[model samples]
Target: MSPDRANPPETSLTREFLAALTTFGAMGYVVVVNPQILSVTGADRHALIVITALAAIVGSLFMGFIGRLPIALAPAMGTNTVFAMAVAGSGVSYGTALVMVLVGGIVFTLFSASRLREQVVMAFPEAIRTGLQCGLGLFIAKLGLMGGGLLTRDGHFGDLREPSVMLAGAALLATPVLLALRVPAALLLSIVAVTLIGLLVPGAHGDALTHLPAAPVQMPPWPSDYTFAFDFGSFMNHLALALPLAGYFFLGDFFSATATLIGVTRRAGLMNADGKLPNARAAYLADGLASMVGSCIGSPTIAAYVESATGVETGGRTGLTAILVAILFTFAMFFWPLIAAVPAQATTPALVMVGVMMMEGIRHLDCSKLENTVSAVLIMLLTVTTGNLVIGLAAGSFAYTLMALALRIRVAPVLLLTDLLLAVYVALSALTLHH
Candidate 1:
């Protein structure tokens, strides 16, 4: 690829802007979904919406300006779910959870600044990395289907008679057809089409649209309620609880961000000849800083979101795309009502399509090696089944290490150490469950 093709200049600003808009359309669901998930912790729903947007804005801006990457950032799905369901639901105060996030962010920053983060990334074999990408892809698609109500809890097809399901089905079918026709912003267009259909159709609840917001316009208020609300007393009083939760937060953020940066950058042809991402430390710093900012503003730990691939797929090659995403997130704050009116089903197609795109990494794996193939497949299966990326990665890493040792293959010492650490993490998690 030529220099212009690798890093397009401002001459391609229009294309970059459109790519960013496509990314926003694909990922804008986080504006509503984050608050819905975190509100389980006794958080005010309105307050969470503002905080979530603010976090995304800050994180994306950092990625654009400092990291100089096309990656967008947001409060991650799995971490937020764990924060609400495991941390707060387990009787820990919300403020204490924020403290855990803050501490975890600090730890993450330290790790990224040192050799530890690089070592971990280096220890991951090529096959395992490909597996991680494929697993995350499946995970993203599953989330889309589940959130859109296209798939039932038991993994069966949802009732298509339902208006939401029908709309989602239309989106699911329209996305690929549009892409095949080489339509620009096909994902975004499918979302808009389904949203319009949703608005016209009466919903299952006898409403104009069951998932639409009550109002279509509203001014967003600042989330003063949660800003700087960390409870040091609660955090310090429960070292045992805080330590484990903090570890979970740290590992989840670190691994997810690492995987996203690697997968997205490789897909965009940003990796160097040595398979290392250039200026990766800067990206990691941006991710860590985003998490810290999120904790301060009463949101979950923010990280580099894999959905940024949607923009990259659309010819986004530089920080310009991320800057545009940050601007849109800032604007989205004031358009909460309009955003909320677009149901989750409308965004389902984009997520599913992005997942399909990410799955292309599987082709790079050496499937002829049985150990590599088995580990990769296990990673994808466990990720979708357990709904946890950390668990899936850890399980796959351990399996890969053991299989390599049994086959008398030369294994990196770092990988063996990583397997030990993962074993300890799993044991701790099991103990926490029993407690």
Candidate 2:
């Protein structure tokens, strides 16, 4: 092959920088939103802000330099909510939750380094994977609607008379239009626009867009109370509880990262003939390691952000895009006050839109098949209604396996084993709840 064939022309630095900037804009909302979700576990808000940014910085740097991939990593939205809910429901301290994350990260790292991870990914039939993605999308959208004040606690729509609710409604309507127009950083722009509207309009309840900080700029606070604050005693004392939580975290993180890698790489035309991502090991290792680092810094599981596709779509072809994102995140640490000033109403639209985008996976599923349609619908409904990704996934997997067996369809041994394991896990979880 000619040298030109062997080595593609280098991407323009201008394009790379712009792509990186766009990716950051698309994902930067995480810096504020993660802290908001996780703070419900009684974590210090300022500390969460710092830790969220720090985790993103660490994960993005590792993904860029070590993995040589254009993916950005951050404290994942779904898993962070899971962590907070687990802590609240189990009466566990935030430190104990961090310990669970640590344990999950270790297990994930081991899986990533071995062929086990690959096997697990392959075990899930394509239809099942699509179902999981769709379920998660709806789950995220539910959370967004709740956060935006558009939905009431009783699952009814909030009062349209409320200015905050009106702002959220506007954002919800505008975001899709912006996206449809192929606007760059459309989600981020929607957030800013909604926030600006909130600042200008006083709510019926006297709720302003956000409480402005005394200082527009200030040094980010150190997360001294949270850093390395794992509660080993609690973790060990509640081994049964901790084990399941860790397992759930591991499963969620692994599958989310795997799906993102597959989707992003395929879109970028970076997949090999065997349909495997180039440098897959490096990317997986980086993701797993980032989770561990995030745990140490008092954040939930960190994983590859699907928004990295924005950069790829903008011509990001190398590690440079990721590095730039890391650098931007590092700088973002100094702007904690401004980031924190963003209202939930502003960020909710992005989450909803992202959820909508994730649901696109469902289009690839064979909806004509009864088993496929039922399983997918069940997974989506259970995940949203139950408010637990693990339980939803387990129930769906078990249902799929049983249906396939009844129909005499060939099932992979690995998938069958997964189904059995999940059945046991669900039973144990029920026992725990009963006690």
Candidate 3:
């Protein structure tokens, strides 16, 4: 047999489909959750859901075709929080807020298209990279544990006997076993198994955990209030108020997408031997473009989703995996209730399992250096505690830079500028995004 023929073709199509299914299972909650968040602006709920799916579809397509990685994209939770609470809650119209998102996307897309964005990402030390990876992983695991019904957000245990908790437990236990046995599509299988369990078993109220919609497939509504609904006039009228908000969206999207891309690609072995990300420009450009397209379609700050790790954990390595994700998003738009039926609890195990797999990056860190250890640990710890990837990276970068300076080590000028900008964003977030 020829040596060239010995290599597998990015795993089988069946595995790619399974990986995409696992990814969708992990992130499907966004279809429901995003609408609720955006509805704070008084947008129509039905419209938001449809737009949310559409945003995912568009972003995933960009990532699949341009970025060409296993990662998927969707409306970001953090930026949406900012858009709803800070931008819209302050009394700007939802349309005005979307205008801000649109402008921000344009700015990010422009910057990402240039090599400067890649340079900024490459300037960071490996410690920061490792921290970003381990941090996002831990945060995901925390999300799983919190949503599994066995634990509160503040670290307390919930009613352990709750039916949801029990079901999550079943999945939590089952996923690891499937993984250990090297089963194909283990995470996807675990999610399906748990969903079936939810359908059959009686809960605390003595009813099935999931109540299926009478009709599984319903045509999605075309958004009347949000699609191409930018209030550019209102945005222009409120330039003083709108400009800063747009700046936040632009800067935040830049950093958050950068962190997610670096973390997920590194996890997928997509980084070059020199430890720099390959196709960083296209990946970032796709991320920025996704946000722009999403904002126009009534979503906010669409970028690469961290939950794409679940697909990577299942042997996905090529863009085909992301294409399948886009395909699933298309189905999700049409079959909203069917998609929604898979509750957060069912997918908690896959997230938890994928998160566990993500922690493997830590072992490869340069533990011999105290600075590296401290910076990486700080990033991982703060990332979870703060529930923000960019914030965690900023904090770790500052720590790393400070240590380097104190030791009289030379730091890149680009990194110094990035740290300064990140520090400003971190300070402002306390009063805005995370507020």
Best by TM-score: 2
Number of clashes found in candidate 3: 0
lDDT of 1 by residue, 11-96 (tens): 27887797798788767767866775676588877788889899999999988887777889999866776677545445678888
**Backbone clash count for every predicted candidate, in the order shown:** 0, 0, 0
Full ranking by TM-score: 2, 1, 3
Ranking by lDDT: 2, 1, 3
The TM-score obtained by model 2 is 0.90
Prediction 3 global C-alpha lDDT: 0.76
* Winner of 1 and 2 under lDDT: 2
Off by over 4 Å in 1: 1-45, 69-71, 76-104, 111-117, 210-215, 224-226, 229-283, 304-321, 388-391, 410-414, 428-435
Worst ten-residue run, lDDT, model 2? 1-10
Query: Which candidate's lDDT is highest?
Result: 2
In candidate 1, list every pair of residues with a backbone clash.
none
Question: What residue pairs are clashing in model 2?
Answer: none
Model 3 lDDT, residue 90, Cα: 60
For each candidate, the alpha-carbon lDDT, in order, equals: 0.78, 0.82, 0.76
How far out, in Å, is residue 96 in model 1?
Answer: 5.9
